[model samples]
Target: MGASSNEAEEINDWELPNGEENKKIEEPQETTEVCARMDALGKLSSLIRNWEQNDVLTAVAVVGAVTTMAMAYSCF
Candidate 1:
């Protein structure tokens, strides 16, 4: 079964039920760390929090490409 035109349009727009619009909640910004190492660690933590599956796939692709290049170079 296929969705009707109205239903398809709603899905594309990501509209909520009852014609409600999405709202963004403001978050408090974090204070900057005085120490460089602490700031780096904080950024790393943030990266971990926002990590996604695509990042893992890209890392794997990089490793595979490097390995292939090394193997090809060794044949010279």
Candidate 2:
């Protein structure tokens, strides 16, 4: 009974200190921003890669028009 009684108190007090708790909980702000930028850049990069893969980027005229459309879409 005595050993069993101590278990609840011990478990109740088991906690990482406040600083460590904050360190664990409050991370990922910079990581989140970096990941978002990486995602946007990856999307644009993949589009370029696809254009190249399909023999689309070889033409300067089409490249110009596509880039203009991209710029307009992104701005709006």
Candidate 3:
């Protein structure tokens, strides 16, 4: 005894019977952090914001990058 052909065709219903397939992913409440990295990033953000207010931070950043690059090339 086997399922009739009609029973096989009915299994192809387009939706799950109660919308179970439409569920969304939920955000997790906890996350891992590196305290040192977080602190450095916070300080950097503060410096940028202070620069925005005082108007010399961008120039300082450019100088800082040039200085770092010069030092790196000198080392090699």
lDDT of 3: 0.75
Q: Which candidate would rank higher by TM-score, 1 or 2?
A: 1
**Top of the candidates by lDDT:** 1
Question: Candidates 2 and 3: which is better by lDDT?
Answer: 3
Order of quality (TM-score): 1, 2, 3
TM-score of each: 0.41, 0.32, 0.30
How would you encode candidate 1's per-residue C-alpha lDDT over 11-70 as one tens digit per residue? 676646878666567997655654766889899999877978999789899999999999
Error of 2 at 63 (Å): 6.9
* Candidate 1, poorest ten consecutive residues by summed lDDT: 28-37
Q: Determine the backbone clash count of candidate 3.
A: 0
lDDT of 3 by residue, 1-76 (tens): 9978888766553446785554457996543467677888999998877665347866888899999999999999
- Model 2 misses residue 22 by how many Å? 19
Candidate 1 off by > 4 Å: 1-34
Per-candidate alpha-carbon RMSD to the true structure: 18.5, 11.7, 8.0
Residue pairs with clashing backbones, model 1: none
Cα lDDT, model 2, residue 44: 92
